[model samples]
Target: MPEVYHLIVNPAAGHGKAPEFVQNHVVPLLHHLGIAFELHETKGVRDAGRIGAEILTTTSFPVKVVIAGGDGTAHEMIEGVLKAERDKKDQALGRWELVILPLGTANALFSSLFPQPPEPPSEPSSLVSYLSDTGPDVLYQLSSLLASLKSTTPARRLPITLTSLESPISPPTEPIQSHIVLSTALHAAILSDSEALRSSYPGLERFKIAADQNLGVFFKADVRLIPPHSGKIKQYDPSVGNWVDPFTFGEDTLSGPFAYFLSTTTTPRLEPSFVISPLLATLPPNPSDPPTMDIIVLRPLRDPAVRSALASRGDEAASETWKSRIRQVMGWAYKGGGHVDLTYPAHRGETEVKGGGEVVVETFRCGGFEWVPTDAEHEPSHIVCADGSLHTIERNGKATVQVMDPGHDNSDDGFWVWA
Candidate 1:
């Protein structure tokens, strides 16, 4: 325990329920523990980041920050602290321990850090029910946080990705740091559209609505994957239940009308049940491990059925067919990230095929990647989502992402989380 814990509360999070939760549950618990805390309520967008920077710059090492909101709030605060640390060139900075209280539409980071036990097999259900059924609620998460704080539980360092947009026509934008996810293509489009539905659908249903809207739309781009330091880029092979080289010719680049492209660092699931990158949880990264991100890729052209349909039936019909396939993949993702194991049959005519074929979803562990939109007029392809916030890559612009190593030189510095 530090001198005093700084509580950054996002009042508007969880459909305006965060402040109420803090008052009803968090405050009383802190009082019971005899812990001293200072409360700071966010007034508007990015306020938490401002508050976080202020606290970090004005305080000493080994500070504790209890964030009472969702992934977006946490992202902002981390960005703030990181920026502040970078700016303070003359002084040595200290570690900031984050205690997440999951109070938002999707508590991706919090749920990932403290995952619940696997649920039993069940039939497919609505998005609302699926989200509601999975993961621990605020009360459960709070208790876990309290337990960790009370015990000898050591803090875990967080790995982050530094993303920047490069363009010849326009000036460069500041590099953005993302602790959870950085994505383009379908995932980016869904996040971009979901904000519009936030008012109508306050819960995770908005993401589903956004997914439906963007499912038929394939993004045109060129991707280049970079290998991790002291390691080669490896792709997950469902057949062998292991990783291997993705390309036969040893090329590191891919051309795409990509169906889905998303990379994650900390969290395996974007929502409570949507396990987009299951390996992150199964093979958690160590502080000394080379910096790498887990990427989930889906290309409609890779499927022979989809390719044949595109050549014979044309774009619209092929798109409709692809939508069904995407829905199937999403169903698998909700079922403990079973999508990674999906493979197409070898022969297109094979009706009862089981084992051998190209994998439908490609999973990779790599240092970083770059995405360049093939067409300037392809508006959807230009969108990028870092954490929950959205950004647009200018025409002729490309986005580059690289994972940063969480150094172990000093135990008092860098971001840490109370698991």
Candidate 2:
């Protein structure tokens, strides 16, 4: 246990349910466990991060931060701590741990860390029994946190991605650190659009609506995959059921009218059911190992069937076909990230085509990647999302994303999570 638990609560998260949940459930549980804590509520955006930095800087080593909110709140807090570590160099910033309470719309980090069972209980049980026996299905994360608090096991180290904008047209900007995801193309557009719909939808439905609005749109960009510490950029070859060096010929740049391009560090699912990167969970990374990002790329033109369809059918018909295909891939993503294994057949017809040839989706595990928009006039292609927050790469600019080394040397003290 730490000197004290700094409970940072975001009242606006989960459509204003976080505060109530913290009071009714979390507070009582902490009291029951006889843990000393200080409560702080966030008034607006970035408040959580500010409070987290304050706690980390002022408190002693091995402090505990209980975040009673969603991924955005957690992201802000982590950013605060990381920023403090950068700025407050002379002062000793003690090591700390994060405990998450999934009170947000899309608890991506929480869901990835403590995934729910595939099947529910066969028999119904009382609320008390459920809490005592298996834990609340929805509130099970809290139970996991509490159990960890009582155990002697060390917290798990969390690897984060550092995303920087490199612009020749403008001066250098600050690098953004993300614990969950950093994306462009469709994912960035969806996150960018979904914020506008938050007031109206205020739930996961906003993402769906945003996806509908941006589904047919294709983002043009030049992507380059940087090799890991091993000096090899490995890609998942579905045929071999393993990762292989696809760029052995020294080709790393990928030209694309990309449909979807997203990368994840700690999370596999942005939503509970959305398993965008299933390998993150099934084949987890070791904390002591060099950090690498799991990237999911969808380039519709790479599929020969779609290409033949495009040449036979006009742009409008090909657009519809690709949109339908994207939708199908998304459906597969929800069903245990099945989209990754989809392959294209060698042949095609004028009518609708189903899978069976070269792998349609390109999945890679790399240390970093760079995204450069091909057209300066196309603004959507420049949009970049770092942990749900949106950014734009300037004209003739690009974004470079790399995993930060965690506590590899004496100069750095990295982050960890109470898993």
Candidate 3:
């Protein structure tokens, strides 16, 4: 049997059921598997990262760390592992692996790992059994997968790109920090405003309220779409059921008083039912490219119903249209709506892209991006969310984000979830 370290556990995940389930089921199963272990708890935001870093620095054995919470906790663990090895040589940092337990409102990361079944809630013991009894082989396979994921170059400090939000009156200064998650535009604003309504709208409804509050407001900004490390900007061709490189005539520039824009690092599906990024799991990141983010967007002006005369009616129409679009988007998400033909409507109800469509949403994969909002107004451009931590954009500024793996080497460590 090998020694393992379980990272921070948030007792409140899944409405406080995770800790009990782990104690009753996971512990005994780990014992049965003959794996030695230890457990740590998070005291506050970002604590998990610190704890994980500590383990990598102080511990001197081959250990596996199991994170018993949701994606945010796991994210911190990953960051901690990367941060711990910053001072060490590159050859030693690429050792640990990550494993997770899904115990949050939206266990997106777990859903990405294990596809959802069209059934009801099973007890935690069943899930525990599957992960502990049936998962070791997967871990062995991951060991091989990781070997291939290692960078061909020397180990270096994995630079994390942070997007800073600054107020317009004041000049922007510090950058917002994150390890796993990052967001801005609509998603960031929704999370920021929705925080106050969390108790009333305990789950996803907060997002709805935030959406409603910010709905008709057009965001004026310039977007620079960077391609992935090893691939081009891929756009889904409905006819092909696969991604093809976006056929742009010139520069891949996007302009807006746009509706939605957001990205994710690991998990594509945000919740159990919300299957937002379906292709993420089937194509995990490779060493040559590394695992990056899939950005999803919804631009309302691309709809054919849009017109200059309707410019005055834009706000009112946009609110209704946005509501309808959101519902449709959710439905499409449920049905794996890769085929939803979102055509711009022409005058007299014609569906065509003669001039262009208004509802054209763009999806892209990239190593990083830049979001520069217009600065002419008193209101902030939008909020930015990094793994649930929110930051408001400063007036007259932009937020930039880039993705890179944290460097971990001989310093001392690797992640191990219970198996």
Winning candidate number (TM-score): 2
lDDT of each: 0.80, 0.79, 0.57
Q: List the residue pairs that clash in candidate 2.
A: 344-357, 345-357
| Model 1 error, position 67 (Å) | 0.4
Task: Name model 3 segments beyond 4 Å from true.
Answer: 60-63, 82-93, 118-181, 199-205, 248-250, 281-288, 312-323, 339-341, 346-359, 376-380, 405-419
lDDT of 2 by residue, 133-159 (tens): 444464575744653564556777677
Which portions of model 1 show Cα errors greater than 4 Å?
91-93, 117-139, 196-209, 247-249, 349-354, 407-412
Tens digits of per-residue lDDT for model 1 on 1-419?
Answer: 35678889998887778888888767766675577889999999888888988997688767888888888898888888778777888655577888888887668887787776454222123223423543345436574355445545577777779898989887777778898899998889998888889999978899889998999898999899988865888888777877778842248988788999999978899878889999887665555667689999988888787788889999987898788888888788998988888878777643121267777888889999999999999999999999878999999999999886555576356777877
What is the TM-score (0 to 1) of candidate 2?
0.89
| Model 1 local distance difference test score | 0.80
TM-score (C-alpha) between model 1 and the true structure: 0.88
Model 3 residue 322 lDDT score: 60
lDDT of 1 at 33: 59
